[model samples]
Target chain A: MKLINILSEKKEIVLKKWFDKIAASYPVNAPSFLKNQKNQFANPVGYTIEETIEAVLDVLINEGTDKKAQEFLDRFVQVRAVQDFTPSRAVDFLFMLKQLMKDELKDELQEKGMYEEFLLMESRIDRMVLASFESYLKYREKIYELRVNEFKNMAFRLLERANLTFEFKDDDPAFEKDVSDSDNVK
Target chain B: MPNESKSDELKQDELVKIDYKPPKKDWMDTPVHFRHGTYIYPAKAKNLTYLGLPNPREWSPADEDWKLPDNWKDIILNGMKERLDKYRSFKVFMDICVRCGACADKCHFFIGGGDPKNMPVLRAELIRSVYKGNFTAAGKILGRLNGARGLTKDVIKEWFYYFYQCTECRRCSVFCPYGIDTAEITMMGRELLTLLGCNVNWVIEPVANCYRTGNHLGIQPHALKDMFEMLLDDIQDRTGVKIEPTFNRKGAEILFVTPSADYFADPGIYTCMGYLMLFHELGLDYTWSTYASEGGNFGLFTSHEMIKRLNAKIYAEAKRLGVKWIIGGECGHMWRVMHQYMDTMNGPADFLEEPVSPITGTRFENAKSTKMVHITEFTADLIKNNKLKLDPGRNDKLRITFHDSCNPARAMGILEEPRYIIKNVCNNFFEMPENTIREQTFCCAGGAGLGTDEMMEIRMRGGMPRANAVKHVHDKHGVNRLTCMCAIDRATLSTLMEYWVPDVKVTGIHELVANALVMKGEKERVVDIRGEALKEKKGEDNVR
Candidate 1:
């Protein structure tokens, strides 16, 4: 079988192992709750992890370098960004798939001599790790931006009342287009 | 050279360390790590001193030594002992938990952050363990085997970290079979921590502000008047109806109190404007107070005594102003205290008459004891009686959803009333999934004084369930406006939405109401209260 066929056939295998490995990052008793409580509203973190990781594997198994991978990974990263994990540790699980895939696909890979194709798919995950790293930093920056905006907004109307806040004076004609777009009907 | 190469390899190994393996130690034996985003800032000494709380000294969680009182352990024990004796509910909650793990994953913080410690069961165990270790014989004999531990500085540190992490939203209490109030456990944990001069400044400073400057942000009377004057200008400019609000005026028949943020903060100020416009349209005899300027009691987050001290002003101001009944504006915990604790903490309110909506003549039997009606209950009555003409089409440009602020939905059951008002005021109103609304509402995750900017990260994390549910409607129904009654929701959920679902805007329900209300002698409405351009102009919807 082609390496892609093997990957597609073994998709459920890969997702289960990946989900279990990621679920272990939570403390004792939590992994069970995450695995068992399948309701999205009740187990949002688990749901996000489950949903996003599948989307992530789909992007890899189908489109090796899908641009939407980062967006899929962004939902998962939003939970981890504010969590107790370091930036590298937060995205480290993405790299675990190589070992997972190798172990699960060893017989198929050795028989078909598909190590070269395996490396290509592995490199796609490497790029995804980088994408998630970028997402982590992006969310971290968004958090700081949120902090600044929270302070700014706590008194936003008060600032407007005091005339401390004002519209950007039109130095650029292009800004008018953005203004007009906002005026469009929702 | 060989040693330097080894160091480089070790550093690389540490950098690439995969954190998939759970720590081998038990949850209690595992060392605690207080990451930056999870913990709140310590209370300032001045605020503590102002409230005359014990051990008023400057301290930070980062320091090696927390500068605790010498007898901090004894103080906490005694405080716990006193509470266990005084509160039967606390005693029952302490002894009653079967640890069935029913509430284990119910917490938004636990669900989003994935920290087992944030679980309502475990978070309660942080204190319940101490109760076991110190008070129960089985715990003293069995120790760690009995799920109990001694009250040490590390235990205190964990308490401060975990308890403040709770918004005291009581979503957990909704699911517990025994109905253990984990939010009250957090409140008690916070109250005990206050005995050690350990509490967040975000809560304490507001308590002091309530004492010193008459509101949470310390906006003085004249400054509050100035802010209201700005709202008056916006009202006049938008609607061409000139209305003046009476502040601390006597004989107004009703005294209106709201979180100070309503007048001083964004989006909340628009809600404040809505109150003004609605009252002016009915010509209701209501007055705002510079004295009871704050309806939100940050003291509720501090201690019950602090709750009494801070909440005493409203009744005092009510008596002084000679108002008949109190009408609290859109706030979460404020109504929790009003409906649940106010009469007990402050009194029978014998001086004030039962709240009878002047326009609709509907007696608020629910508020007869406290003599304070929620603004939604009052306004829903107004809309019910057809006393106020509404133009729901003015809000046609936006799809809307109501977030039942945790306290109002769970504590007071003010669920349908707010929805009733929202439906009357806006044509497009969708409910979030059943699990995330009504009595099961998710918190804004910034309640109980955790709403400060420094606590932003966890607030966002803990707010995920709420944001996720909203994301459902936002994507499925194209709901862009998340209207809520709580002032904290207005302030914090905006940031939460920006992080999770940036398309959605957090709005106070009344902002929608004022936009739809057909005020008398008003000019052609051109803008909504936030000064946004309106889609359907006055009388344009009628023609359509």
Candidate 2:
């Protein structure tokens, strides 16, 4: 069987192993809890990780991305973006997929003489990593936008519109600092 | 520097090291990472000074020296001891945990963010360890083995990070066999931090504003009246009933006080209009208290003492106005304060009569002691008695689900009132997943004064469980509208919904209530309080 065909058969094991790799990224005790990934409500992070990784793996096998696949990636990357991960670490799970594919199915690809399929799959994972980076940045940017929008979402804009906001006059003593000013006033 | 944690320096390399191995250090020994988005800004010196809180100084958490009082250690220890003595519950909670870890996965923060310390039990242990080390002989003798750590400045920093991280929503307490109120523990942790002036700006600034003005936002009476006039304008445009609510009037039958957010904030302003429409329809006798404009108490986030000081104004205004009883608007922690703490903290409401809905003649037996009835309970009773003519079809455009806010659900046991009102008011209403509603309800993750902007990342992470449940229904039953009964939920869950489930917009329950309320001689209602046209077709995704 070819490497892609073998991956199709071994998809379940590959998913479980890939889920383990992502779980390893979290803190120690958290993984033990996240390892029980069946219940979605109780262990949302685990469930999302399992579900999204499975979907991302399937997308890689098809050698492209779809809306559903991108959404799965979006949801997963959204979780990581807000988490304690840096930009690279947030999307590094995609890179981990390439490493896992190599480690898990290395001999199978070598024996099957399908370096081209392996390269194609690796590049696709690479592309997915790039896509995950896009999603991660989208969420991070969304968080900052949400922060700004938070102020506007309140009675703030209305306050400004109604001219209720107290603006300091340019000539006001409080607005203009004198030469003999104390830093403590700030 | 003390601020730059060892864990942070090695975080990037340590995170991507993809080997199946143990955590680098024990959780107890693990230094906390004060990442930018994870923490809130420190309380500003002015806000702390305005509140007369201790150790007011301008310093950042990332600084080498926090400018804590020289005797900060003694201050925190003494404060802890004082609280442990005064509140026996604190002492019992400090000693009683078996750490079976029932609450580990229950925390929304931990469930969403996967942070180990965000676990309710461990978060409680963040302070409880110090309680053990300083208070218990066993902990002092046994040290880290007994899960006891000293109250170092690092420990205080960890406390500020973790305690404020909690929304005090009490979801984890629902699962605890010992029935430990983790929210109280968080409150205690915050109280000790307050001694060192180590509270968050989001919380302390609100407390200060509430202390000076009657509300957290510090809207003066004229501005408050102006805001109400704006709402009345919206009400006139929508319903054509000119609401003439008396502010701080003498001898109104009922004193109506809501979180000031209702008068000003988005979506909450719609709920405020809903209250106006309902009152107008029923001819309910109530006066707004400009002095007690805030029903939500940020003092509950600060200290028990502060809760009393901020809460005293409510009763004082009720007395001064001589309203027979008080009707609090839809707010979560406000109700938690009114129900659980208000009666004891600033009570003997002997000045006011028991709350009886003047329209329906149904006495609010639940709030007989507090003399304050929740709007939902009042509205529910009105619907129950068929006193108000509610056109349920008016809400035909929306499919709704009730998000039982954490305080109202867990703290106050207000499970049925909102459901009763929703069923009587709306056409299509659905419950979220079995575990995510009622007493097992997840928090908006923005309660207990953590509902600020800089902590958006943590809030998003913490809101995941609530959003995930909302998503479940949004996918399953086309739940386009998420109606909650909290002011914080109104302001914050809108952001959360915007982030997690973008299509689902949040509404206060009364906003739905008034949409169906048949007002007296009102014009043909075309628009909801938000100026969105009623009976508009549900477009592809949130086409409002």
Leading candidate by TM-score: 1
Question: For residues B107-145, what per-residue lDDT tens digits would candidate 1 score against the true structure?
Answer: 988888788889999999999999999999999999988
State TM-scores per candidate: 0.94, 0.92
Stretches of candidate 1 off by over 4 Å are: A155-186, B1-19, B540-544
Error of 2 at A22 (Å): 0.6
DockQ of each: 0.57, 0.38
Compute the lDDT for candidate 1.
0.87
* Stretches of candidate 2 exceeding 4 Å from the true structure: A62-68, A158-186, B1-23, B536-544
For candidate 1, the per-residue lDDT at B218 reads 85
Task: Write one digit per residue (lDDT tens) for candidate 2, span B262-330.
Answer: 888787888988998888777777799888989989999999999999999999998898889988899
TM-score of chain B of each: 0.96, 0.94
Cα lDDT, model 1, residue B462: 90
Query: Candidate 1 at residue A93, lDDT?
Result: 77
Q: Is the docking of candidate 1 incorrect, acceptable, medium or high quality?
A: medium
Alpha carbon deviation, residue B439, candidate 1 (Å) = 0.9
Chain A TM-score from candidate 2: 0.79
Q: Enumerate residue pairs that collide in model 1.
A: none
